[model samples]
Target chain A: MHFGPHLLLAALEGLVTSAVLALTALGLSLVFGVMRVVNVAHGEFFMLGAVLAWAITTAIGGHPALGFLAALVIAPLIVGAIALVAERLVLRRLNYNPEATIVATIGMLYIIQQLALTIYGPEARPVEPPFSYRILLPWFGYSGYKLSVIATSALLLIATWLVLTRTKIGLIMRATQYDSETAQAFGIPVGRVYGGVFALGAMLAAIAAALIVPISQAHYLMGQDPLLLSFIVVIIGGLGSLRGTVVAAVLIGLSDGIISMFFSPTLAKIIATLLVAMVLVFRPQGLFGTASR
Target chain B: MTDKNGFFDLSKSTLTRRTALKGLAAGAGLGLAPGFVRYSQAQSSAPIKIGFQSHRTGIGAAYGRWYEKTTAAAVKAINAAGGINGRQVEVIIEDDGTDPGRGAEVVGKFATQHKTDIVFGTLFSHVVIGSAPAAGENKMPYFVVSEGHHVASTKLNRYVFQPGITDVKSQIESMAPWIAANAGKKVTQIFPDFAFGYDHRDYLPPALKAQGADVIAQIAIPPTESSFTKFFPQIPAETEVIYHVMVGPAVLTFVKELGEFYGPNRPQLFGFIDSLEATDINSPGLEFLDGSHFWEGSPRYAQADDSVAQKAYRTAVGIDDNGAAVGDPKDVSTAAHMFGCWETLYVVKKAMEDAGYKGPEDRAKLVEATEALTEFAEGPEHPQGPKTFNGKIHQCFGIQNISKVEGGKLKVVHKTKIEDGLYEAEGDYTTQAL
Candidate 1:
């Protein structure tokens, strides 16, 4: 419990938090960047993924790794399909209008939350980690599963970056984002691109939820904190910059962990919020966002 | 009928066009003609509506669900036993969302719109405090199952009463003797940074000190925190016991992280069952708590020497021997606190019967009758344990249970006498005007 080891543990905890937050915030950034829609129900989709993971793991009934692997593959796909249906039924009808879509996603938030409550009930159920290995250091012990989460998230972020920047789908999506009318005139099928981006964004959130569910239990109200923190990351990272989102998540997560160690938890939150406010006032465009054209 | 002043012949017994139409509409709105007749005859037999302010959609939803089930079971039993004063009991539920602002609004609605006889069943201390003012303003007798010291401190108005569960001050005071003697002498406290946690933070030290045990460190974690490893370092090395009382959804994470941090080499752990009321003790990450102890208001798992009354209460509440809903093993009950809902309802029935309560007009008399209550025996009506009520503080003093986790089940290890928890009255609720 020396200062050096304590700082190392706090930093490691911060890294785990940053891993989940980056993936969740990246989803929001992707949707905002391409479709120009603020999806408020994004957090509920994350919650759905966690809940589905519990159901799947409980039903599979085998080695814990087998159930976790199955959940990792299936939960995100189901959540993506749910997001696709929602976009078609609600967001598309609103013509992706910023204000109208915001309202629609908020409605979706409550609908999904209530549905989960009705089906899963109101308990915070835990999912067994695929592996339970404690790494004992001279200073303290740590969860090996937590370290796996950081690595998995890093790989997923890199894969997502490659898909967005180095593929044909990425090119079309960027073209649509730059000018939807121009892309449509160029026979790019801009509507399909928008739909795909929305689904892909939600899938990213689901993936984050599936990975973090082992560390944190699945509860009906668990989506609330992630939603607030994701919004904070998206805003401070720059409106639609993926790089900015990841950097901001790490910055916020590390500061939160370190600040809480020195000050009372309530005061630490106040300080974090004040820091966000100062950033908004001083740099309106965010750390990585380009100035509005 | 119209009166005969030439403005429809003022006092004459003549039916005017307006009167005839009004009679026709009223008769139709009341449904079949026999329904109207039945309504008139059944006015005195109407059920007594107890408005339930529930946290159905918020952070406290898990506790709220159990409270609802317990309230329903108690009402069913009361109705089956010929009801209270020959009238069946009814519960009108209003969701409070667990927010203090919304809780106040729910109390207002219960008093004005639902027009219930009394408001009952709130658990979270902040919600209870938020709703107390509305109860006082409406002059409604509020029976809260929340074990907060707010009501017992006599800070709130006389309309509020906590007659079922003993307040947090008493519960904390009672634990010191057993903890100091059995658990450890050097205690470090870890609590949430809120009103609920403040009760433990402010009261436990003095009580422990009185028992010849000194509290070396106290760490207050924010309510919103999910991860707890970084805070563990703040606990002093020389500490022998870590007394934690964390609440909310993140409790599992707190416990899991604590397990990983210590890994079978930690201080003696003593925690309030509030942290894991509805949580399964056999959970994977919770293996570290195998030999730890917790304070339970009532034992979760059935005891070997349970009273007949306790057994009957469990059966009526639909919980199996494992303290879970019968047929649903995974759905654990909040056994520590939900018993308050059942006991409080019985208290309400006794008070109303003693006051000859007929309607809301008798609320003042009911309050006076409730204030006169002194003791409750351990029976079907008060199954948790015997209790002595302090009408002056509007609180109750009851026996407390200390249980240890053994073989994946909690076993009751100690039970504090009611006198151990009794304290001097903070202020007298009887001094306040009705």
Candidate 2:
């Protein structure tokens, strides 16, 4: 194949996948920084956002913006409410057992996926891409929308960083993650803090689902890949550290992009997982994790 | 578009109005013309029930929708032709969601409570395997439209039949030799870790072994897996052909991923038939697979001109009626499915007419007549295809091989018309023989 077509396609594929990877890791970072529980079902939340976006968007004449708006606005509110209820009912009773919470969230994942299948059907509902614009770069072609994913996700990432570091709610959310008991001792309503954090996490997932799904499309099973990748990102970047997650997200994204260009998709993932495992074993708390943690 | 005789010419007789009215008066109670009355009967008492289970939201939705569209069109056509021995046919469709348990439940409802005349359309292999037993137990004739080899393997049920080349073997049989003959005679395979992808990849190497072709390596990642670039370095360097068994979006992702991973600097790539999709040819990563060959038994969307029967099928189903090749003109899944259902119904109609269906109560007699059919000779539904039922196997025979596009049309590069029993298969359940 000619280099023009080859490089163009590689760039497009990398852009699509990297966008999803960054957004998914962003959610994990937000959740770990606040609730201190790895929301295993974050991918499911992403999936819900996609399905919700797809349902609304497809029903209303194939508009991605509607789905994006629906997902961005409604998904967090709904899944946040569910997270609240889940917190009250389940997480509250777990006595803060990290392992138990992890297992419970895993259960939540299957339950949600099965429920979705029950109601929506198991087949993939491919959402029409929001727009069709191919920019030809001197014998190479790239979808305008694909480039948009990167641009949009980058904006979201920057906005999230700004909110977490610059806003009042962001300060409280971080205080809760640093020390829940002390945050409560210092007059922070830990319950409300948890709710806000969960909502923020859900919102990140929804936005990612809404934005990235235009390329990968949406399906029930799509949640798993990003979920797994997000976990790797969190582990590599350092749990509960937004800055670290961002660094690792970019590193992993770039690594995957470049490696995939030279290898198969399956091989690229295998290599990424391998690298993450090695890093985890060698650097227990992750690249940026505090030694105390 | 034609009668049982396979002739579309209505030029044989031109009668005067007086003569036509006289003939109408002579056969006054025959219940034939002004077909509107018959369709109105479709909304009548008990809703002439036929059950269909399909993947409404699963991976098979594309194929499932086509099946539904074609079936709906055939029902309308049947009603126009004075439906099912004068009782208009009404199909009650259920979404199986592409899950076996869901499929089983839908079949249970159709065979028991809904009590349909026949049940048709299950898109997944495991779903068919799980639900076929129930259809056989209840003696309800089940028509499946899946590509799983397992259904053909069991051959246990007397009531279940899925027409065409029932296995993925046909593809391997066609490709292994061809890839060996070209592409440096060394092949590496990559597929999804799940049942759908694993089966084809697993089935192929053995098939290649039987064909005296050497398989370099086989790599499988999880189904619906997002990336494959990690494993690229591990691929045996001697490998030349890459058989891709990935399907749907995952396949799209894999191809795009592979395109990026393996450039012109890498070995030449090939793929399993399912991965050769025309719709995704415009995918940014598709340039990598442009010249890659695929072997499949399914009718290609970009292939040869529409056969006479296919043209009639297009007209019967409100499809464009333009051309019938895989990956070109349009998604041919709709046309392909319409042909299968249309042909199945045509065979049932001929059988019922031969056995003299007085009403829905004659279900037993209808099954017997269906069992008794020896062959179908170039009928309006089959056109150039055949419909032969071995009373022993309860299977109908015929299939079109997969094709690739050349100059905006798909053409089958392999496969020859074979004898009827060449693709014969039996059901997978015990049945009370009619």
Candidate 3:
């Protein structure tokens, strides 16, 4: 009703968007960080996750929670496994050449998109939220599911941070990221590390899709925007910096939400693009990014 | 003998030159005598090839999938009923990818590569707009089933016509009064930012104003936008009605987000079927819209008082009473907009017969014949309802349905008359140089 209340609501909406964007962008950053190969089909993996979630939920049948839980556990694993296979068969065949992988992943994008079209059909299908309850705000009531999405996404982000900081696999991944040839010299199985990181990156994207699918319908064409937005986030964050990606996601996501709420979506996009230009001009390596040698 | 659809059936045993003559006599009774006579000539009885310019692989893919099915079913029925002119009706389909440039290219392919007699079956407004000039240049009769006002607005040449479907202007004009009175007077409009959405943005205000209502806030959203919560906060708090007509792949998200943003303290909701075009109403998040109203070109679910023709058409199209494919419940029909494909095919048939269209040489004659058509009856050809075709404007005036969500199905609560949508012709396609 009042300006203050509306601003608060806008911020709340921004947080939800930021939460999803962080998970999705972190995946892209992680893949670029360790592998030095940009995955053009990352968005397709996200889309596949949502589609598989729909299929599994439809197949499982019964209480939505059961189907949703099963989808949450299975869809990302399936998507990550598919990404692993792609890395092994396609990226490995190309020797993970940067320019070649771009073209290869674009091909992968179309292949996965068409396959989803054939299997999922062309309809945007709704997956029932596992539960629905209202949380009353000062001005209006909000969906309980959205709050859960924000919470779950934050938890997933924290878990990712913990894994990267505290685990053996994370240490191997960090070593690989530091220098693949050096890591190989140290008996790290660099190729296997690349494959695992690729899979992990895809899994993070799939997890984000699985979480958001209930709010947004699963569609084959749904990948394009998220792909574009994720690219923007990664670029503005400095290509391979995970911390920068998270911070950039929050900034872009919240600004996009709040600006779109107050002014126009077109204006919001214009401002975001301008901000990207400004960031690239002043801080070419990004805020948290280390300058390359 | 007759079939379930009241079509005259010929016994397989009676197959000869005399049988063709007998079929001519039967055709006379069925008002297909000209077609039969043409068939009897026997010099050229090849199937009348209609090129279907489809959006098989883009944002419009969902609508395209259903439109393809409906077109196939219509062609199947027409072929079964002794073909269009005793020659089988063949449909040659090419995927346009729903891109405007590709749309025009597809039209060019139909004109040159396929050598289709006529090109038809494009749905998205931008695609139709992009492709129409190509049809004109190629002298191909372009019969569009798109609901965009572009055809009727006469931005397109004489080659384009939207005779089977009502455009957004007509639809909004017809329903504005009902929306104003029953839903609310002061409205907050949320529409996709595009030509199609712009039609609603442009037309609805004046139409609503005519009914003593005003649009308070007009929020234009990017068509491809998936998340919509940010846009919801922009709607004025004092707004009594939220009028939404969103398109693209994120319609479910748009509606679900609106529901979430407002919850129990929301304003009245009125939406075009575009908001939930291919979505199930009983979807968990959409329960908030239990009593909201939607404007449908045709009711998604079959009503109790559905006409016999509607029933026959539904059976032919494989859409069950619930508006899903009979074989798969989850495969929901794009029931609102797809009827145009079925109806447009019939209009094409009628025009072809009226013109005694023989081949590509008589394309001009067929166009003129289509322009001469005034009315279509509520029958198998137009299961949506009877419509009045304003051939001058190249648009149709049809019954518009305002349905409420009841028990997870749209039940028609209001139906507007053809006259409610009538307006002065924007520019006459008939007057345009052919």
Candidate 4:
């Protein structure tokens, strides 16, 4: 078919969406690692990244490459700075009450959405994909840009895993995750680690948003799905478990992709939601999640 | 009217460039100077602050962009012609993001902060419903290129006027007679599972029944649908025609999947105005739609009564009457938006001059003048027929009818005039048929 390339490129959107969702889940898992706070507003950070991506990109002549990367840098940094303030002000006060953290983040989500509407207004504007050139595979037409996304996500994931497992900072982060009080008593700067973890989680989400901006047009409220998808992934993979996140993300992505291809995209959502509900009822801790005490 | 549209009768007298000259001349001398001043002033002093709430990034992005681009083009043309009473129509366009709540907020900001004379756009029914009240409260003329029942509801105020009609039920009204004329058997109905899907669901049953046409089937998915694969197989072998109205990415996805599933025995497709969709007209599934029809406007087919120049514009733009442009396969939105923007801006220019509004300011007065506006030249809806928004609900009272696709684009096939109050709806299924 003459439109074979177009058709393939469209299908590639599913894969890229998966890769981006994996990144978002990575943020969720990392945040779970330290504070044990289910940051409901993690997707808000992703949304901020998308918003900033558009802002920075449009400011820079809509050159998506520089724009997205700039958002990548700026989004995480801004979110991290905000996280720092929230920690000093809000989360620090709620240390004894985990539910408070959840409530706070949920509140923050609405605030952020409203703020975005104020800043950008509600409209879907296509962000120029940082690259030009559709990669037309011989068998069908797959987008080169989507392939680029898959590659970039692969690199980021590897880099993240190495940082968490091989470095001294990684040990500190893991120790802090197990019990913040225990790690602090051992003379580790648990507070600083917490800050860093927050920054790191936010940074991953920001990166995901930057990558997603090109394919999914930037809008004020695009973060909702990624956030939901990430929550599902992190739990299914096991909380604070990087390997679990990776596997779950890919699995969910593939399921979503194939379902969308064969059935309806809406029904695929219903199926995924149902799957999550069933998993929670039976496994509770998730496929890879450690048994919660 | 079914076989030959009354609105596009080739024998009808058409206003030519020659007749338009006197108006154009008066427009140029008076129109040129103030418009030039206003336009240049907007570019130079104020950035031409025109406010827009377009759905550039959401489900309605397809509809919103056409409103944005066409309005932008019209502003460009009006500014080129002279500037509105002379300041360039500086536009502050915002993407409505396809959410009604967001739309309402954007409308508020445009009215209060941006202080735009008028706000144009938003094709989604929900978005229009959410946004229009703000404009009406502010008494700002909200010109929307949208189709929503609320546009004609009692809630409607003079501040809102649809340059295009609101309710899409009429598209069926215009097209049904033709199906009655052309088809050998009955029609099936299929649509998405949402509000629009339900709206059409309610609209077509009686429309077909009114024509004494048999209803073969009515297929509607749940509100939480992802695809139409499950429903595709149910197209009864006895069903000869299908009346459809699915939109957005779903349009391409649904049709392609259906065509793939249908193979050889696909139903003869009948549609709401959506069949004239610039997005779906020539996609992979278009072969399945070769003989399918939609009741629509004259942007695709030449209105037999239109000026030669209208046909020339269609040919020159590589589009028929549907306001669709060719070149990029997915560029229907751009062309549709550009045309709407052009027409909108031009209409504003005419209204502004007529109202004697001035400069890069006077937003309130400009809006009033726009609300005061009543008439515009009718043009053929490509892939359909001629349409004009000439009635009180701000809908096109006499100008709407049926349209079909010809030459890979939409053209006028039929037309009928229906005033807002004349239709039946106490939830009663009785209405005069075509």
Candidate 5:
């Protein structure tokens, strides 16, 4: 309960939040970067991942670790498939028009949310962590699984960075992002790249939800907060900049935790929002975002 | 004829328009015409429509589901036993989406579109507060089951009533004596930062102080907060009891984090059952609450000395001994508070009958009738317990159950008397104009 330990605990908690926010925001950033269309249903995809995790784990009915591992692998894949179908049926049909796709994705959000509510019911159900180790500090004990989430997120971020920088698929996506018409002219299959990027973005969100479900119970309405936070990260980190998204997520998460410790939580939120507003006024391009061409 | 669903079959009514006209003609010819009496008789056959404002899709949806079920069961019972004023009771539901703006709009729809005689069955305090002005503007009697002190504080208009459940102010006040005597003297409170939390934050200290105990620390967490370990350090080192009352989906995480923070050497934990309503007590990460105590508006787990009415009420509501749905153990009922929905419906029926309520025109009479009632005895209709109604403030005073978490189930350890929660009236709703 001392100042040092309190600050340390706040920072640790903030790291876990930042890790999830980074992954979720990265998904949104990628879709915008390549497709130039906002996916409003991104949060619902995250919710779907968590709900599917619950169903898969319950169906498996074995060791908690086995079920959790199964969820980690399967939930994202299922969510990604669903996202692909949405792109084909809705987004592709809209010709990926920015305004039309925004509306279409909003429709998808409701459909996914209502479907989850109907199938999963209105309860906030918790999933047993893969492991239940408590890291007892001299000051307080912490969930070992939470720390694992941070590490897992970091590894995933690195893998994603490696793919974007080094792989042919990443090269195709980036060329399409830079100029879809030019990429198409060069036989890059711009449409296919868009579809793959959309699916991958959703998959990232799903993965984050799966990781956080043990720490926070999966409820039908749980997507709202994450969606809002991810949007903040996406906007403040500079849209379409993965690096900026990760950095902004960490900055916002840590500040939120530290500020809340000093002031009332409501006041903390006001201060955070004011800070975001100031950033917007001073640097419209965001902290790392370049000026638009 | 009445249908099996307890609604009247209007097609099978014996009194046709022709027959009514003939009766009126005959009465006029006999110089015994009583058109008003005949009109009243015809109107009495129509069903009483009660509009239910539900939280079907938002944060309060879990509680809303059980509230809907309890309301249905209560309505079915009331109709089966000859409903209010010999008319069938019909419920029309409108989801409020658990948003204050949506709540007010729903109340307006209930008044103008549904044309319901009364709007009832709202649970969340914010929703109730937001909807009350619309009810007052429309002059539709609004009977909410929300346990918020807003109704008792007389801050809302005269149309709003909280006759179904005791408000949070009374519930919090009642816990002080029992907590100070049994739990601990130096208490630290942890609650969500909102109107609901403010009720406890503002009321508990004075009540505890009166009982020779003091609240050492009060930590208010943001409503959106999911992680709580960072805030755990705010509890004073000399704290003896942690009185936590949190609501919403992240409650499981909060408890889990609290457990990890304290490990095995934590202080005594006393929390309002609102924190875990509709949640399984034996859930993973809740091992820390094994011996903690909670305040239950109604006992979730059936006690050995449960009254006959309580047993019958549980059966009627389809809740088992463990307070889960009869067949689904995992689908836990919000047994602590959902009983208010049932009890409130019965109160509505009683008031309607007392007022001879036949249509919306008699809404004022119905409100007056409800306010005139003073007490409800423990029976099939009033299953939670006997309660004293403060008609002036439009809130109920009821005994509260203090239950301990033992053997992975909440066992009733103490029941506070109604007087323990009674406080001087803040204001009188009767003083306001209808």
Candidate 6:
């Protein structure tokens, strides 16, 4: 293989990683930005989506595409509903106190993980890709499913952007994020906004999970790595900044893919950790974060 | 120190009638109910407790689930056979979460809290390595079913023994020549970057060299890596064969990504059964692997020449001919590595009976008796075929299976002799203080 094809392959692979990472991190950013509470269980929501996708697809036996489409719609709604319940019961009771909510979400994480273990069993189950077309590149053939995943994730990210920017719910969320007490004083229901934002954040993660389940089998312990990586992206990209989350996710995911390919995965992780350390030492507010008064 | 009262001390052991009943029920479910009533009648004698360190929560959860099943099945069989030395054997399980620090803590809990006579049943190599020191400190006989060469290499304590499973060094030594001759001479290895994968990385190069083969490129992937397309371009163009041995929950992804990377036009593929341990071959995306080969510790699919003992064991474990659950086709059995757990429990029974093991006081005697074990023939006790145990290294030498993918099933193509995998004893566990 020549240098050009090899680089193109790596770039394409990196882009796919970036796509998934972007969506996942965007959810984390949205939750933190709107609710002012870190969702430690965000990855569990992601895992729940994938596992539900597997369950849904397996139960409704027929064309793979039909199963996937059903899962694509149903899994996120279910996950979002669960998140809404969690927000009302746990986060709302805690008054969304940053430290308390972190601990609460950690508890939620183990509960969700154990529940998954009980219902899904420990076995990793794969979902059949809806299609099996291979797009022929100049150097090699690529998985059309993977390319579709990249495209789908991008469209989802745009929709998320539109929701946060163009909709009335988006305005209410921004107002509550700006000042919850004042928003409540202005007749905006802050609690409802918080609940909606939490559900939307979880829904975004679920959608990403639904997209990637065909490629990555769903397992109980699959949530931890994505959680860690998303935290890294949120930290580097500036927590609560959706635009910064996207930029940072693309940077981290692409570098991880390219570096892991050329050298070793260990090296890629080391570089990522080093980058995180540098960001912490020099730019505590993160690249796109504004310093609070 | 026992209180001189007529009543026995309950603090020393948690073997209440409730636990005994639970064990009996578990045994019955696991196909070992023949002597449960008899054992319960003689339950006045304290049951021998074995601490089972299970990987119930992490990346090893899939294997851990099967290992627990096999352990239960073996324990049921042991109890049904009138128990070890006529005492009902109870397994006290503790989940290590497949984390190293937690593994040691679980071992400590087994020694101090559970008061188990011996600690056993850890599958992942790193967990074994982490927990072995706790076992050594407690002077508990640790019998692991893990395939890492650490025990045999003298890196672990004398208390740690792998008397039922062949280590990676021996396995690779046995399979290298066959892979070279049948697969290709120019190999490229893709293995997880950990102690288990390092075993393959370290042993296969020299073993392949001995077979007049050479590895052109070696790729070390993180065990947690879910996506693998990025690493495929690194394989040298002239690579004749791709040897992959990946673990964790992402094995299907690893394989699917590999198929995506290579498509129809690919090099010869020879992978360890680790890559597909719990995966169904007939699953959709795996059609690309229809003609590939895999090295299995035990063939996943039951072969035509399977012994009656193998079939009986499968029935007891509820695994069907296709290596899936009897009724649930989607649930796959990790047939390759899980057999070691079943065989190891039997080995424990044999050694315990040989030493007339009565309690924790007799644990040292049991270890020595286990080291004295020589060859195990194919029977209900050893369904994974014949094995010769090396007392010095505390690892067993067993026949290795080379199975080909035919008609969406793994068919045994070659079986290496026991001697083919044996190497010079690295260190004598006997030389170390018991």
lDDT of 5 by residue, B9-43 (tens): 78888998899999989878776545445446566
TM-score of each: 0.95, 0.65, 0.92, 0.57, 0.93, 0.92
Each prediction's fraction of true contacts recovered: 0.63, 0.10, 0.74, 0.02, 0.74, 0.66
Top candidate when judged by TM-score against the true structure: 1
| Candidate 1 chain A weakest ten by summed lDDT | A263-272
Second chain of candidate 5: TM-score? Answer: 0.90
For the candidates in turn, chain A alone yields TM-scores of 0.97, 0.91, 0.97, 0.91, 0.97, 0.97
Clashing pairs in 1: B3-B9, B3-B10, B3-B11, B4-B9, B4-B10, B4-B11, B5-B10
Worst 10 residues of 3 chain B by lDDT: B5-14
Model 6, B195: alpha-carbon shift in Å?
Answer: 1.0
Best model per DockQ: 6
Off by over 4 Å in 1: B1-38
What does candidate 4's lDDT look like per residue over A59-142, in tens digits?
776445776667667766777787667666666656625777888888888888778766665544445666644443453323
**On residues B1-434, what C-alpha lDDT tens digit does candidate 6 reach at each position?**
24453234668876889999999999777775555544464434778899999988888888888998888988998899898888888999999989989999999999998889888889889899999999999989999989999998988888999988899999999999999999999999999988999999999999999999999999998787888888888889899999999998888888887788788888999999999888898877888898999999988898999999999999998899999988998889899999998899889988988998877878899889999999888899999999999887889989999999999999999999998998988777798887
For every prediction, compared with the true complex, DockQ reads 0.35, 0.07, 0.31, 0.04, 0.34, 0.43
Model 1 local distance difference test score: 0.90
Q: Write the number of the candidate with greater lDDT, choosing between 2 and 6.
A: 6
| Full ranking by DockQ | 6, 1, 5, 3, 2, 4
RMSD to native, candidate 2: 15.3
**RMSD for each model, in Å, please?**
7.6, 15.3, 11.3, 16.5, 9.0, 8.1
The i-RMS of every model, in angstroms, reads: 10.6, 16.1, 12.5, 17.2, 9.4, 9.2
Task: Please give the range of 10 consecutive residues that has the lowest summed lDDT in model 4 chain B.
Answer: B425-434
Off by over 4 Å in 5: B1-42
Q: lDDT of candidate 5 vs native?
A: 0.90
- The local lDDT score (0 to 100) that residue B404 gets in candidate 4 is 59
User: Predicted candidate 4: what Cα RMSD to the true structure?
Assistant: 16.5
